[model samples]
Target: MASSFHQFLLLLCCSVWYLTHISQSQSSPLPNALLLPITKDATTLQYVTKILHGTPLVPVNLVVNLGGPLLWTDCSSRFASSSSRSIPSRSIKCSREKAHDLGTKRTTCPSSAQPCEVSTENGITRMATRGELVEDIVAVGSIAGSKATVDQFVFSCAPTFLLNGLASGAKGMMGLGRTPIALPSQISTALGTQQKFTICLSSSDGILVSDQGPHDSVFGPEISRSVTYTPLFSLQEHSIGVKSIKINGNRLSLNASLLSSNGGTKLSTIVPYTTMESTIYATFIKAYIQAAASMNMTRVASVAPFGLCFSSKGIDSKQLSLKVPAIDLVLQSEMVKWRILGRNSMVRVNDEVMCLGFLDGGLNPMTSIVLGGYQLEDIVLQFDLGTSMLGFSPSLLMWERSCSDFKFDSWPKYSL
Candidate 1:
């Protein structure tokens, strides 16, 4: 009896050890990887993420600009940081210094008298005054799981007036563009990881993941799955190659030349919904309306910014998704396609109205097709600079998972 009891206890101990080891291994990714939780402002519909910024570390909310020039914050009001004493902007002429960035510039933020000219992906121009330039510690990743810190992180401090059009809580912007000063480049260098970043924006909340790994997430031990790659047209713009678009397996008749042209299709976090040129929008809307009618979906009066709206009476509450037709963005070849199902293709404007989530950018839009944030939610996208490729996955909802389900969290309190 004594021998048998000892044997049972040993087996339980070994089992406990094995379980603990497995948990640790699954939570920690190979080499380096950090996840930053992001949020979407209901009023603005823009995705923003938080970070521990400055000395004495205060929470700062920043708008994620996938192609913006640099990471900037508004330090105009009630901005108190012991580390904000160093002045680097004017000495480095940051406004004129577009390319060269050391990634570690200690400085103080002084109010600027001049407002800098800033441009958006949608071809809108805005005036922004450059504030102070400072380098301090910035933390990313979840406090619960894992966190990575940059010892000497640098970012610009701008005036509060620049926060006019940003998400409700966002003070400024965090750039992930070609500039060396952007978050991707700085984090890539600081962590000694790959020169890439992955984005998985969810509705109201999301994540900004950097470095490389098949990260263990709430979706299981693999955050990277069902991923398909298409060559990136440009890193600066995060542009991708598109052969064509199909509505419910039926191809929309469009100018093939437009798909292969210079400014063909772009991925944007700025715009709320996908925007197309006048010709493309008209063609897409016509095909979608026809497809809806065939499905017996009710068409209601058009809403502002949305040319097509439908009644929720058409939606079958059961069986998961709406009966709407799927959209396929054929990329690289016919085999590789990004599928847009009901969750991504439709937006509930109200209890009675369900609007087709797309926009028309008048006649001459900068890029022919600007894929916006709404469609980007519940999908995983990797902007891999290492291979000049744009990797994407189909809707996560198909697996009964959301990108929001991925492991991520943040510090609760923040200032400005």
Candidate 2:
């Protein structure tokens, strides 16, 4: 039965992958297929026995065939699959029955009638003791590694609102305002700026903020009652790659560290906001900032106020680690995968990471209509570096463009 179940899952996964990401032609809307969590449990747990965990195990070796007006590196590309390999284990478990349909095996509550919400605040999702993601509710999806670059794997799939009270583990979302999904102007009246204030808003699906204040606040306020502005997903900031440009004759670099896990993680750098690296990275960070300047990207000025702080080698090559701020998520990138090296150790490589960060409405403006707001894809990913191997997500590699195979290429063309 175990062998049959495993084989069934493998086949289901293959079918889902091909149907979602591939087609006879490439012009169709980008595929919405996403990564789901797979839980493996041991037969027993001793009083002092080590807890087992599960890590991302994406064995897909995808070769994207990029061709068209789109820039290969610009978040849209095809994916190829590869052979299967085992990843690390953790203290996650599920019923043997739930493991039967591996491809569609989502974490759900014990009732199986209720759904689970992926906790964006801590980058972790709660599952039934059986280790199942509540079907349809909200649950974080697992990824392959400890550290991930959100920019890489964010632009893969489209998220389903699943009004049936179920939302897919998606990527690329953002928090527009405080809670109401209203514009800054509307919220200002309620909170009264410079005053400690809070308002009520609807609960976020996979694309909005999870109001930590109160679930009943929606019916409490008048001005706050009406959700305004259509909840726009605005552009935050843009930065250029340090390697692509030079500052003070030194290659520029942007280092992001998780500052606090309050609403989400606030990524800050070690350098104060007025350094060279910050200037350079910020200069080229925008999607269309280059086109707006009409200047050779290498020659653009590093004048973005947000790029005030810059650091050279902020993160050491030997070992670089940062904390992920606790914030509600919109969605997570699916292309990236991870392996757990440690489980619940709270130490380097032996930590628990549960979530996938994918590109979403925040970066790809086109997805906003469906996502309905600024979205950031954060899924539950379990990882412990103690007994895991390094894995890579296709999204992490630089995007390439070609009429043929769309592998990572050094030079990808862009149109203004």
Candidate 3:
């Protein structure tokens, strides 16, 4: 099975390469010019940027998070006293009006306390304390290179963080949500540009973020177009509208109503970078397993965390390729269909075993789909809050592309 899967992936790659080559010859230039290096730390992807909290600048590693809106960093005494470049913590009176304006769920500022405790919806129990909203310079891309700086940026300075499942090396997270305090909005306001950012994740190389141009430029004739846009359901969580899911070409009789937002349930679809398996409704998983079984795929013993496993020992790569079926995510937009490639769906455990890179998300009533990083491999995702749309395209960069080529300080400059 492993050999067959590998062969299938190779065939798909060849076909895509041929198609991309032909398209590139006829198509215009790509809109994305500024490509910064991204580091893959285990399952999570991080982007490095310099933050000017004080006089001197400090290099901070931040995880690229799209689910939350607030940007914060650990403000422990060790971190603060280690470098003079660290932003100083200040106490400020909490305002009820401001708290109400920002919404209760976001603002953890107590009615009387100077230091605010903020909690994030990272699906974890971690909490971060906010010292005060300080004005600092945030440099994206590189410190010495053609980087964009957002001066007087209002971000929380959390002195401490109780984190789990996150890289300890990371100082904080760069929030890409649509809120006023989000990195995208702050950067857009500072640069006087549209609130837009692009994320390109690959199997080998990590994640790349690029500032997107105007809507006219993006959809115009001047820019080389490789992206397809779909209207975002909500900017708060960067949710996309998924209509249905299919195994190969056959559409499962899954309840579309369960996937829609109603009442207090906000059924969102997010692409998470910290996990390998895409979590879906348990019912959907059953349907998927049935589909695979129909294709003569032999089910093996269940692995921890994953419900489906298959024996791949002694199986020819080409044979596995011919046996496995394709999975397609049908979006709300009829014109767009995201087909899950082989490399994105299967994971090889050992020399003789492989498992589906998808899991049953339980029978929770909440409608949410977390598309894991594995599924997002080699895909470019563009979040455009200005146009209220999400764009996707095949990553132009190859998996074998070295991270050293696009180092933060050595990145090539391009005019916006």
Q: What is the lDDT of residue 409 in candidate 3?
A: 36
What lDDT is reached at residue 15 by model 1? 100
Stretches off by above 4 angstroms in model 3 are 1-36, 43-53, 77-131, 142-144, 212-226, 262-280, 313-323, 365-367, 394-409, 412-416
lDDT of each: 0.73, 0.19, 0.54
> Ten-residue segment with the worst summed lDDT in candidate 1?
116-125
Candidate 3 lDDT tens digits, 8-28: 999999999999986664443
lDDT of 2: 0.19
Cα displacement (Å) at residue 318, model 1:
6.5
Off by over 4 Å in 1: 1-32, 85-97, 100-125, 128-133, 142-146, 216-218, 221-223, 317-322, 408-416
Q: Tens digit of lDDT per residue, candidate 1, span 1-416?
A: 99999999999999999999878766654434566778888887777787877667778788887877677787666458776544443444444434443332335553454322223221112564534565667877643455678877767766667777776667788878766667887888887888887888888667777746554433453446678888887646678877899988999998898766657788888888999888888999999999999988999998888899999885952321559978998988899998888888888888888898899977877788988989899888878887888888778877777877755344333411
- TM-scores, one per candidate: 0.81, 0.17, 0.71
- Give per-model CA RMSD: 6.6, 25.9, 12.8
lDDT by residue (70-125, candidate 2, tens digit) is 00010112132222111112213223212222234345433423332121110112
Count of backbone collisions in candidate 2:
90
Ranking by TM-score: 1, 3, 2
Against the correct fold, how does model 3 do in TM-score?
A: 0.71
